[model samples]
Target: MNFRARGVFTLILGSFFVSGIAGLVYQVVWTRYLALFLGHTSYAVIAVLAAFMGGLALGNAWLGAKADRVTRPLLFYAGLELGISAFAAIFPAYYDLVHQAFLAVVRGLQPTGILRLSLQFIFAGLTILVPTVLMGATLPALTRFVTRSLAELRGKVAALYAINSSGAVLGVVLAEWWWIPSLGLHLTLFIGAALSFAVGLVALILSRRVEALGDGVAPATVTSEPAEQFTPRQLRLAVVAIGVSGFVAMLYEVAWTRLLALALGSSTHAYSLMLATFISGIAVGGWLVYRWKRQAHTLAAFAVAELVLAFTLFVSLWFYDLLPWWFVKLAALLARSDPAYFLYEWLQAAVCFGVMFVPAVCLGTTLPLVSRV
Candidate 1:
């Protein structure tokens, strides 16, 4: 690669690393922190995490709509990174205050369990809303930075996603093996904040260089042949369908671990395994979709994938109770012998991976197709 290409690749890679660390911190640390402070009965932590993720989706939609209008997409993304870092720095204090406020309200009203849970959800949502939204804005913003053509757009987006997901997998492993034990919860947040800020600075600097070289201008619009023309409704439908598919795939992966844990009567470790498998599946799926470029039909593929996912969920639910005891016992024995927790965990992961594969592949195919339209 040339100098400019190398710089852009480095920027994307750094952003992926930062994103991975941030995701890992939230997944492994935040929930435990909340549980410790609010008692194990608090489902508020999960609620907060969910709200954060939802906020990210909203941010992506909002930022993407205006991506073409933004003169300095890198600056906007950097500002978001800084903002998220600042929040991470003060999250402990903010969370404690919110927890106390919740308790005081509960004491005054003597609310039922459901009411308390509602309050917890609200508190969690409030704490994570801004940062999560900001984090969500980065992907589309970065997409604009990296892509120059419709065909390149799909491959670039897929590559970036694979890089980011790989970072997340590493982050999860690091959090469990190093961050939580060595740095503790608060320090882990600070470490993630530092990484985010560093990545933002690098991206901003590289963007400035591109602008100075006159390489930042929008690519000239190509005249479409009559056969290539698409109605606005079709264009909008395609974009919306792809976005929805992406969101659904993410949500299902998020919830799959808990569902598996309930089925196996085991610890959350099984769920963690499922998450790892799902992310890996997405990375692999993106690669395969890119390789099978000519065979991809973005919308049709997405619908079929969604249907398959639904079927898988139904099968898992239906068969869970009827699973033979010997099979479960043998699986557990294999899991115990495997140092990486491969066997039992992989089984759970396989189910989650099956649910994730189709939608991810479909969504991966959509980016280039939609950009072309």
Candidate 2:
């Protein structure tokens, strides 16, 4: 924690923050683009989404292993970011190719509903998995780069994740408010590419500086962390909790969006804003984790976070009954002061915050604590 070390850590956090923004930008836009190609049916949309997440899972599983093993984790992270930018640049063309391939499958086979769904998934997966896999690898690489020892992981990973999620909050805001609305999706893709490229270049430069400065830390020092002593039972429980954490988070997002749409309207703004609210809560929770600076009791903390999250989720169901009343009251307040549809943004946010923020924060807290394992 010397001056030089702190400076280097700041640079790394800054890089992760930038990457977080670019990642969410890509995700928001990708859903739009994927929906166009895959159609708007629930089944089709889910298929495309599953493909998107599957790629990330694949990357986390595969490259996460390589992250600590790599001699230079910054280089590994930079490569992933650069690869994401490169693939994003070409993704439109790649998407069209996949679309053509999908149509050929339909025309040639004349597949039924289930077969078509499978085909949609296959085609969508083929189109998106490359860049997303790279995106997924980033957290592991960046986390490894920041933590030179098992003990160093205590709050560091969560703080890094917080910075990243903070960027994601802005990313969602930018895409919704300016990027898509101003530049259109195609041009927005280029903007995202440029962001990825910028981060990659920064990382590459930092890597060289680390070499020249010696940095008081070897490039390979992360690999020298003492072995963990978690028992088989502890490891198994932690792994299960990680899976459950992801599942519950995803379910909350999907459910909250759908439920809110029922209360609010189905405008694109509601969807985007709800998503932003979710990420913001996560970002807040991450900050809380770093600020708490408590010991890392991965199992106990993870379990408590999950339990609180579940209770919150159940409590939210009761709150749904009150949304109608809340909206009516909100509308009345707006009506008094010369309301406009644009003003509904406030309403959307109030409703989203009411139910989602706390649970999302819990979702944020769990990952960091559990990752200590």
Candidate 3:
């Protein structure tokens, strides 16, 4: 690739890595650490996860809607970096404070279960909203930075998505195997925050240079028909499909974990494996979409994959305990003879392949179609 191409590619890849680590820190490390310290009540962890995702979706929608008017995308990124840094720097202290507060509440009036749960939800929501919202703006901002033409936009977007997903896989492996276990959650968050800040600084400097070289011309904005212009039926269909696929994929993943946990008689490990598998599937699906050329056919293929994924989830849910006798016997034998970590790992792989692959393929294909429209 030429120099500009190379530069854009590097930025995308670096952002991918940083964003991936940030997500891992939140989803895997922070959630586990908080639950461990705060008690595993669904009120605590699930509330936090929902808050983060909700903030992320809202942030993405906001950024995408106003992307064209944003003259200083780098500044937004810098703010994200600063926000993350502040959050990380305070995490240890904040957790301690929250824990102390929880204890005080328990001691004082002895709140009902519902009241405690409400408190947990509020606390979790405030703690996670900032970083998640910042992260949500990233892809749209990066898309604005890298895209130079309507024709090339889809490929550029796909490349960035693929790199980020790949980074997510690495982040999961590293966080689980090394960071959380060795460095601890606080330090891991700090490291991720530092990386995010560094990337922002670099992007800021580079963007300045690009502006200088352009002799005052700003970066080109994405060309799309205004919202006031009615979207054609095909475009509407594409958007609906993408949204539906994404929602179903997330549901399938959660269901898969619950099913596996029940079958395997282990909840925590089964959940982790499901998450890792789903992330890996997204990475693989992204790469495949990046390589695929025919947009219309790609969409069709993705639709088929979504159907398969839905079928798989339905079957798994319906057949929750009906595994062949030999399979259960084999599991029991392995559990008796050795640690059953391998079983969870294998199940994780199966779940990853089934749950992640199809919807990811479908989602990946949608961007290209939208860009084409």
Candidate 4:
């Protein structure tokens, strides 16, 4: 990449990092807020998570296909960011109105659990789908924008993933430790919206500047090959691998969270820490792939990483099985003394980190490797 292109790519990645933070902040705040109205149940968690992931999948499949067709990708990207901000700005009021209405009607009817759960899903889906979908389109749009050629694409994508995941880590930490606690939900929402809006403004300005430089043609179409370049077998394998990995990773995340709850207390603090540690592994893995630039060995590396991840996770299950015993021993030693809570929390954190960190890192590394392939 030329110096100017590199500079623009850097800016794009930085913008994405900020946007990632905004996205996670929205997830943390909105989920908690909705739970207040819907009541805390496994159904509520499933509804929220489904809405978030479903929106992303929709955006990725729909908008991603269109990203490469846009003449000014940054303009498109900026518009998407603005859309997310607009939704974020309005969502609080919308959700409150919807939740209250639903609660009143459901209370009058005294609905069954399934009916109530379905209603929660519908409300959560409606409240979050627009912004979350817009957030999802960002990866494909920004990836298409930053890398002008196929050769540079993988590295740029990996780097962007790294920075974005790092931003998520920061967001989770801040939301738990500072933002939600200090700013409260409305102000926190506005803050995230502002960051996203600022990113959109910056992208709009850059789009115009690039246009002024006479290289403003549809960037995404420039010398890019279609997926048909890969053989049918390879394409099928890729699809299968992606699906398997996603399913496995998500299942593992839920299992690990439950296990960690036994070690740590099942507070928001513990949940936030768990997410941060898991995502940090992904960020580190992406950064490693970007820095190493070893695409030739990506397939082998990915396979090895997957094996390592699977093995480590299985081993960690055994550790979890023994964790309660270990916790009791440690607790007895502490014996409700001063700093007992602090030390216990620290111990929980350490145990959680030790068990998941390596497998999560391996999980993270495999993603970029697969993307590279």
**Least accurate stretch of 10 residues (summed lDDT) in model 4?**
219-228
| lDDT minimum window of 10 residues, candidate 2 | 216-225
Q: Each model's TM-score, in the order given? A: 0.80, 0.90, 0.81, 0.90
lDDT value, residue 132 of candidate 3: 77
**For model 1, how many clashes?**
0
> After superposition on all CA atoms, what RMSD does each candidate show versus the true structure?
4.2, 3.5, 4.6, 3.5
> Model 4: per-residue lDDT, tens digit, 1-373?
5567667777888898998898888877776776676676333445567788889888988987788888777788999999999988988789878878887878897878788777767877787888888877898888777766666576678888899999988888788678888989898888889988998999889988984565632333333442324567875786788678877877777777677777675565677677788888888888888787544655667778889988887777666778877877877787586678778767877877887788878778766766665
Off by over 4 Å in 4: 41-44, 104-109, 211-230, 331-345
> Model 1: which residue pairs collide?
none
The residue ranges of model 2 lying beyond 4 angstroms of the native Cα positions read: 41-48, 212-231, 296-298, 321-339
Question: What is candidate 1's lDDT per residue for 219-336, written digit by digit as tens?
Answer: 4234342224457797788778767766766566555544555544333344445556665666665555546444245545556655765676666666645444534655656634
**Candidate 1, TM-score vs. the true structure?**
0.80
lDDT of 4 at 174: 80
Each model's backbone clash number:
0, 0, 0, 0
- Highest-lDDT candidate: 2
Candidate 1, which ten residues in sequence have the lowest lDDT sum? 219-228
Candidate 3, residue 222: how far the Cα is off, in Å: 16
* Candidate achieving higher lDDT, 1 or 4: 4
Question: What's the lDDT for residue 288 in model 3?
Answer: 68
